[model samples]
Every structure is written in C-alpha cells, then in structure tokens.
Target: MPPQLVLASGGGWGAAPKMENGQPVPGEFVVPNGVPVGSVAYFQVGNPNPSYVITTVTWDGGTDIKGYMSGTPTSAPAKKQEVLTGVAKNQTSYTFVVKAEAKNYTVRADVQYANGAKGWVTVEFASVRPTTTLAVPEDKVGFQATGDTNTHNVAGLVQAIFFQATATTHQHGGSFIFMQLVKSARVESAYFENNKLVKEYIENDRSIPNGEDFDGKLHDDFLNRLAYLHIYDGNIMYGWHLMPGRSMPVPAAPPGGTPDPPMMFDDPKSQVPLDWIGNAFTSSFSTYLMYKPQSGVWVALNQIDWSVSQAATRTGPGGTWEALTLPAPTQVSQPSTPNGMAAFPTWVNFTSNFINDQLNPWRPLD
Candidate 1:
C-alpha cells in the first residue's frame, strides 16, 4: 500500500511518502506556499519506520521570514505533530520603499518567499521639522548744560566769576541754565552769563579791564562788561550803590583846624586824583569808597552786595588784620526803597584803633 498523507492539526499539510513493501517512506517538506512581507511561515516533518532515516529538510529563499519550525514526529500518521520552533533571521536584503508627505511617511515592504514567491505590504509613520522666532530695537534719553545769555560770548568769564564768588562769600546757590540735545544734535557752543542764555562765542575777543566803566551803551556792550567783570556794572551798579546808604563822613579839617580849601569840582588840579590804594578802610568801607568816593580821604561804606572793594586790613587790639567781613543780606532785597532812605544804617562804626591803621599813603589829614 502507498503511504497515506494527512492534514496536520497545526493548520498545515504533510506530504505522502513513497512507500515499498507496506513500509513508511521519507521525503522533504516545504511550507508557506506564499509569504507576505512582514509575515512568518512554519512547517513540520514526520518519520514512521524505524529504519526510514530522516534527513535534512531544507528551506529555500526563506530569508525574509521572521520565524521557523522543525521536529521529527514520534508516530506515523498521527493526529497532531509537534513542531520545533526556530527564529528567522531579519532579512537585510529586503528593500522597504518609503514615500513622505509634510508630516508623515508611508513605507512599502516587499518580501521574497522561500519558494521564489514574493509579497508586499505598506505602513505609515510620522515626520517633523524645527521652528524659531526673534525681537526689536529701542530708543535713548539724557541732558546738557548751556551757559549765560546776557553776555553772549563770555561763558568762560562767567564760569570764572562763578567759581570766584563761590570760593569767597557767594553761597553755593545759583540758578542753572540747560537744554536737551536730541539724538545726533550737535552742540555748537554755549555762553553762560549769570544763568542767562547768550549766543555761543567761544573764540571772539574777550578782554575786560577790571575798572573799565561802561556808560549807558548797547545792551550787548553792557552785558559784555558784566560778563568780563562777572559783576553787574552801569545802571545795575547804580541801583546797587543806592541800596546801601552812604556811611562815611566827608573828609574834614583837623580838630579846630580849617578845612582844606575847596577846589573847583571840575578842576583837574582841584579834584582828588582817583587811586587804587589798598587797605584804605574796612572792606565794606573801602569797597564803597573804591567805587563811590566821598572825598580825597577814603571812607567806610556799604552797598546792596552786587560787588564792592574794601581795605586790605582793619586794625584790632590784637594786631593789623587782612580780611574783610561781608555784610549780611548779601543780595539786593527789594526793587525799590523810600526816597532818601538808606538801605543800611547811617552811623559808621569805627573802633578806636581805626584811624591809626589807615594804609592809605596820602590821607588828606596825614
């Protein structure tokens, strides 16, 4: 009888063996008539006759399969056959083609079967890209100093006077003038005269003699004088002088002696020659006399503190001194005063030693 083949319990079929003398036969078996890409295939072999030796069951082109099976069945034509399992090596040679869109990729897998059959399948995956963002620019702010306006060309002189005043008795108090220069604005120059804004005149003529009096002239000329002197002159000085009433007595004759013969006021010979004598009186007195003389003899006096000159020294019981004490109310207090009213007291306060310390060389009495 020919060897009978039967379907296996494991969803596979077994091949009929060639038989002789009613004995079992052996043959090779192949599995998976067709293998899909990414799919696994399995198979089994059986030997019944003890003398029927089982040889190798080889698989061809099973490289793409993911798993394997092998076993020798104990009973011939049994209902169930046990399969020995093995792993299929990954098929590196199998090519998987992929198509990509903006955010995803599609992969098609083609598989070659052991029996020269091939299969294909497709799968999808995701893709991504990178991203970024940035920022903007901004503006700036600040200030600048512009000096006096009255004297358009004497900023340096103004500064010098300011420093001098500050160094002396002028308190650290005064107004400041300034302006803002916007982006890229150039500063041509700045003139500072008593906190007034003047045209910038950095390089023009800047000479200002100490006592070169200014008459009622051009406003610019008056301002130039003020700038050079750092002291208000002209009408400003007039008001300033009047503010402090005269304190010194007119020069007189010696006790019970005759007064010096009056010289014609207009006579150059009769008029007392003006001089820059030093230490003639107390600073206040000298200052008043220096600018507002009463007679040939210098006398102590006062003013509204616009500016004044005075004796180089005043004698005290201790010794001859060389400093001047500025009066209080250093600045002008009001715009007007009663007619004939003195800004300060009328009586002059001279110590007993005042007469002996006179530094003037040509005192009328002397």
Candidate 2:
C-alpha cells in the first residue's frame, strides 16, 4: 500500500470547528477534498494500510510565540499524551494538533513512520485580519452648532465657526477669528496619517473605548492632531490645528516676561519658544499652546506678548506636540463656571498647537 501524507480536516465537507457569527472558526485542519487544501490548527497523516502508522509529528513554531504538540489520537476527542511514540500504531489515522497565535502560520511539520521513513509538509494558516469597532470622534447625537442648529462633521464645523457669533457671542475671545485665520493660513502642509495609525492610537489610549471601524471617527479624530502646516504672509510660520472637533480647555495666562530670544533656546524643551507663538498676555509674535490629557486639561505653554522676553522651558511635561501660527490673540473674560477650566473665551483650545515664526531660529519669519 502507498504511504500517504495529506491534510485531513480543514475548512472542509466532513467536520468543522465551532465559529462565531462574523468571526472565522479557529482550529481548522486540512482535508483530502482540497477546498482550502491547507491546514490551520491541526493535520492528519496515516498509512493506507498497517505498513506506515504515522508515528511522530514535529513542527517549527515560526511566527507563533510558543506552542506544543500533544500525543497522537486514533479516535474522537484525542487524549493528550506526553509523546506521540507512546500511542498505539494500529490506529487508522494519527492526528497532530497545533494551537497557535496571530492566525497566520508558516509552520513546517515533519512526519515519521514506525519503519523510520520520514516525510514532512509545510502549510500556512492564511486567515482574514479581524476588524473591530472604535469610538466615534464626533458627537452626532447631541452636538449643537449654536443654541438651535445641530452640527457634525468638518464642513458643518467650518460653517458653524465661520458664521458663529463673533468673539463675545460665545462670551469669550473669537473662535471665529482663529477659524478665519486658519482658513486663510494656507495649508503649507498637513500631517500624514492613515486609519491604521489612528486606530492604533485610539486603541492605545485608555480614555478611548473600543468601538466600530471604517466609519468617519478614526479619520476625523486624527485630523484633530492639529500638527501639520507651514504658513507665510509677512512672517514665516509653521502651525497646525483646525479646532473643529475638539474639546475646549481654558488656556493658561499668556506667558509674560521680556523678549530675551536667547533665553528660549536654553532648554531643549524651551528651545522653540511657545511665547513667541501666542503664549502671551498679548503678542505680535508666534503663539504657543499645549495639551495634557491625563487631567483632561489644556495649558497655554508659554504666555507672553511681544513686550515679554523669552525665558526657557516652554512645553510642560507630556507627550509629543505640534503647533500653528495665529494673529495677535485678544483675551476675553471667562464665565464664572464651577470648574476653573473653559470658563473664558480663550483663543487656544487644549491642544498641542505649536507656532514657530521668529522664535524658530531654524525657520525664521519670512
């Protein structure tokens, strides 16, 4: 009788492993009919007659972090054994089971017979990459543009802020002014991000819960990074932030000090002056801003006007950040809110919006 080595029970006709509604069934073995024609979690190899009672099976874990092979099984519900050698050779089919991680495998399996003849097979577990849901960036259900009209999405936000009641309307500085400036700022360049990176970012962030995918949230949220642009008019500036889909955090008192240009370059953190941006009591130079998510608060990194001199250490302790250029920002009185945060019409939101104009000796104002 001819010795045989073939996949026995994968995603085939006879038997199949359990499956979740939308999820692919795990542990699919190989089958003779050749549909999938490959093995996933398990395989079988036996002699046509008694001459070759497939004795042992060995495999390389490959991408799998770790795995183990159990004793041979001739019947249903194969019992776990320390080694395949102890199993009876008279059985018709010898089954080798493998449990792996990450779904894709390039395992190489070797089979040995009682007669010492050896044969091996290489198989791959090509399964679909699982898709998951993510949190939505926009509040479609309860976000109102003003007091009456409801709004969502970027375009809606642009229009809302564009026509939004002037600075004092929201009882704060002009969100509209900043909005208009950004619109005219000329998108010198923007951050490049894809859904994958955004998804990874969302997943890594504890604040963001697991949800759905392929929707607009991932794309929208990433756009909120607000760190991608270089603008110029009379001054050379590099800035970022649209302020469309983000929370409002009270900006810190504008950075107040003298304009010692050399002072800002002292600390690597302060090397690029936030005061130069918009971190000012009032300013004719670049404005700078920072965001701290842990406390859910935004801080104006360096608060300074042109009159104030540059010191050092602009950005507070946190993660990476970005910036954008803005015209001189006017301060508005914050309302008497219980939480001291967002009580005023602050020009900058709680974002890592950085602006580099005269401050950046590297890219000085044009």
Candidate 3:
C-alpha cells in the first residue's frame, strides 16, 4: 500500500509564517492561506500508511524562494532549496523551511519511500507585503463653538487629543497620530493614549470593543525605535469653559501686592500655558512627548505658541474649554516611521528657534 501524505504540524496548507527579524510574529500561525514576504514557514509531513517507510524528502521552490531542511525556523533560509536522504527506515515525519521572497511561490516536495516508490505534493501560496496608510500632515484649522456650524465639540476635542480623526478638519487636538497597516487578511490599527497601550487585533479578530485603545504589541518589529511629530508656525491654548463668559476664581490681594486682574472671556491675556492638562503638562510642552506607542517612542518639534484660558466657568470645568489657535492655524506633521516599515520620507527632527535651526533637544522646552 502507498503512504498518504499529510501535514504533521506548524502552519499547514497555504499559510506560511515567515521569520521577521529572527522572530516569528504572533498570529502568523492562523493566517488563512498567505505568507508575508521575507518570512519563513515550516511544514512537517507525515506518512499515514505504515506499510510505506519514508526514506528521503526533497524540496524545490521558485527563484525567490529560500528553502531549508534543517536549522532554526526563526531565521531566513540560507539557500533556494534543500534535499535530505537516509530517513531511518520508518521516520514518522520531516520538516522543511521555505522563505517567501516575492509575490508568488510554489513549493514542491518529492518524497521517496523505502520501497523506491516516489510520490510528490505541492503547496502554492502568495507572499504579500502589508500596506501602510498614513495620514498626511496638515495644518490644524478652524475652531467653532456650539451652534456655530459644528457639533457638540467635546468629541472633537477628544478626537483631536487622542484618536486619529478620519477627516482633515477633525485632525486638531489629537495627542498622537498613527497609520493603519494591513497585511494579507490582517488589519492592524494601533495608537497610544495617555502614553500607554492596551490592546491589539489580528486578521479580522475584532474582539476588542470600540472606543478602546489599539496598541500593537509587535510595534518594534515594524516601526523604528523613535518617531516624531512636528508642530510649527502656529499657536495652541487651553481654557476652562467653551462659552462666552468664563472666569477663574480670584484670590484676595497679597500682603503688598494687589489681587491679579480678572480674566475676561474675550481677553487675549486670559489664557495660560498648556500645563493645565495636569501631570502630562511638562511632557507635553517638551520635545519628548509623553507617548510611547508599541510602534515606537515619539518626539515632537514644538514651534507653536502656547497659552491657557481662565479657570472660572459657567459649567463645572467638565473637559469643556474656550481655546483657539489663530492668525495662523497650527501646522502639524504626521508621526514618522522607518522607510522599511512604510513608504515615508526622511524626517528632519529639528526646529528653528528664531535664532537658528536646532534639533529639538530631548528636554522640556516649556
């Protein structure tokens, strides 16, 4: 009786998990039927029929396929193909490593049974590279209070300071920026909130609830060690209330100093620096932003003017505020990643201080 060939272990069938940076990324084992380029997939074959003894196995691939018979699967294959002979009489199984280098690959295995009976099987899969979609950097434009051609505006503020807004008009106020990456059937959406990460999803695995943080745990493998956001030629401010008549509580006059003047809602001097956001204040104004998403650590080029609005309010300071960047809207560049990870230009991490050009040093500029 002839032996029936079957997959013994590892990623079976069409999915070939590749070795990335000498390591296997999680969720690669479950990818339906495709392989990411520059990755290696291991396949073990078993002989179901005891009557036939598996003696030798040979692997062949297309020009771009790097195939191996022995060694670690965590690294790329050294050569194009491999052949192994002398499989002790009744060897149960044999494993082969194949690296995807191009768009398509057809890996064929010629199995030699101890009886000299020859049989072969071929597995075809595609090598796909993930596409990264990054939002273009633009100027944060326009500010409209309630009943002024805008929605409630709270969500806008939240969108600005946290999530990546889909529309260009909604891009303001965000604390972090990101790009969506899709590879094969997997769609990865990751970001940082409060400089911390929470969850990640793989290949239509959308179990994570909405309005939740999507921080990819495999960020280091895809992005550079450092990323930067450039804020230049504009202004940013924070205030207590979004309404017309907001004011902060005034203390009594000092021993010899008169009490500070009241902060009028319309006064340009009414606002303060961005430190009003609490603990994140120092980190926010400095070159080093308080974020480290799985993608990478982020730095900033803060050339914007900063101010804060008065503390007093008509409604309890409920994340509401009257703030604006005017005359010239604050222009912000998108967060940067390595060219190898995504298609992006080299980012210059320096800023002009009106005196000269300087690489925004890694310290607080507030």
Candidate 4:
C-alpha cells in the first residue's frame, strides 16, 4: 500500500479521523465543528513506505491559508495558495494556519520513492465560521447554562382565554444546567466498589477560569444564537477560574463536626468516596413560561429533572448520569425565572432569570 494521510489534530475544531476495514483513514472531509478563523489544522503522514519520501507539500482553495512545518514558516505569509517544496528530509507532519471563509481548503503532498515511483495524496479541510471566544465565567460553583423557546400556539389560545401576556412570557422552552458544586469534582475512568471513582489523578480542573466572553458582534450572535447548543456541549466551564485556592464552595460543617478531608492522589489503592458528586449535579429543565396553551388559561410550568453520573468529566459537561444509591429524580425548586417569578409569584425581580446569569449576560432564550 502507499503512504496514508490522516489528521493529527484539528485546532480543536472540525477535524474527524476514523478507521476503514480495520485500517486508519480520514473519513468525511466535512468539518462539522467548524474551524474558526486563525486556528491551526494539523495533519499527519501515516504508515509511509520506508523508501517513499515526501518531496513537496501544498495547501490551497480557501480565502486565506498559510503553511507551517514543525512551528516554522514554510510558505510566504498569508496567501491564497501555499506550497512547501524540496523538503530536506522526511516530514512526519504538516501544519496549516487557516482563516474563516465560505469555501473549502485542499492539502496535497507529492511523494517519491528511491526506486523511481511517484505518488500523491490529497485531503480537504472545509468550512469556516467567524471566530468567537467565550470567556468562561468564574464562579464558586461550576455551572454554565443556556436556554431557548418556541411559542407559536400562544396567539390562538389567548383569544379563547381572554387574557394578555408578554411576547416571551407565553413561550415554551427548556434549560440544561449542571453544577460541580463539590470540591475536587472528577470523573473516574471506571466504576468500582461502593460506587467509588477508579481514576485518582485529576485530568483537568474546572476551577480555573480562562478566555473571554463574546466581544465582537460575531461572538454576540454566537452567544445568543449560532453556538448556543455548542456551548452547552462544549464544556465551556472547564476553562472557568475559581477564587484563589478554592475549587468550589464547601458547605458549612455541622457544629463540632470536622469538614471532609481533601481528595488525595498519593494513595492509588484508596478508593475515592462518591461524596464528591454533590446535589443537583446536572439538570435538564423543561420550562413553560406560560404553559397549558390548549386550555387558553396559561400557568407557569418550571419542571426541572436532575441526575448525577460518573461520565460528568471536566472536559464534557451535559449528559445522562447514573442514579447509584440516590433517588432517580430528585425534586428541587425552580430558581428565579427569566420573567421574575419567585416561588411561582413575584411582583419585582428580573436579574437572576438565567441559569448562568452569574457568569454570562447573554441568555439563550433572548
């Protein structure tokens, strides 16, 4: 077989690598996650024949593209087409600094063997959207949320009920919120006795805050619109920085009672207790600002379903969790709604309407 081409990494964007018939292959060239402008795309040369040597590499077919090798400039700055030819030795990898545009970019390489055989391989990196950096909000708790709604049936139902409501008060939507309120929140690689975490080392900490909230008009649209769902799944909270020396807010110890010991990694055999998973770890709330549209008379419906799981890692936030010993669905009160409803009725309150209002000003429903 000839030398194979595969993507080593995708600037944390739309790069997918898969296997074909038990062999590695780059499948589905379309980048679904989207490569933002000014992000790097890394590709690898896999399983090359010992005799085959890469003579030249080229990148083209995008609004702006640049080529780099081992962190060194290989092409003339930013150009429509970039070519790096006459490589001194074998290149195991190549890099491309890409710009967001509407078109696709193609990466090609020319290979030659000592025995006079020549071959070439081409891989296309496509799709680009304007870049938006979400400065993860730092908080005592590790929870960031976003919500959306649909209210097409409100108009007809209001005529039957003979009542009026705000343009957004009658909409139906849901918000997914989860908090790592416990200290030393970590996801285990496997399950163990007494539902303990098997892994000891913390791969990543959600306590550290980094990055910035959406600054430009492009990012503003992303917060309220484009990447709303993406943020929920992107685990934006991992980059959040907590207060100095504090991972999360610990509850007050009972009178004359000692606080729980800090989670330790020195002992591998010591099973870490599940107390690290705090209450209301993750919630999928189906809310009705004004529900019962079929009856013409609408009432607030804020039903929030909560669960906890071992899969709740620092890198990935929203997903179905396990019950373990706790009840499958714990009943918890709904916080202030977007419309200022306290305990189901409030005359004045508007600030704490969003689940993530503490971290971000952009509400998903707005």
TM-score for each of the candidates: 0.13, 0.22, 0.27, 0.26
Stretches of candidate 2 exceeding 4 Å from the true structure: 1-40, 61-104, 140-366
Which 10-residue window of candidate 2 scores lowest in summed lDDT? 260-269
Ranking, TM-score, top scorer first: 3, 4, 2, 1
Model 3 reaches what TM-score against the true structure?
Answer: 0.27
Q: Which tens-of-lDDT digit does each residue in 273-304 have in candidate 4?
A: 23332111222222122221111111232222
By summed lDDT, which 10 consecutive residues of candidate 4 come out lowest?
155-164
The model with the greater TM-score, 1 or 2, is 2
Residue-by-residue lDDT tens digits, candidate 2, 247-340: 2222334584322111110000122222121121111222222221110112222221211111111133231232322221232112111111
RMSD over all Cα atoms, model 4: 25.6
C-alpha RMSD values across all candidates: 49.3, 25.0, 22.9, 25.6
Per-residue lDDT, model 2, residue 259, is 21
lDDT for each residue of candidate 1 in 119-216, tens digit (9 for 90 to 100): 33322323211110000001101011223232211111111101111001011111111000001101122223465433221111111233221111
* Candidate that beats the other on TM-score, 2 or 3, i.e. the better one: 3
**1 against 3, candidate with superior lDDT:** 3
RMSD of 2: 25.0
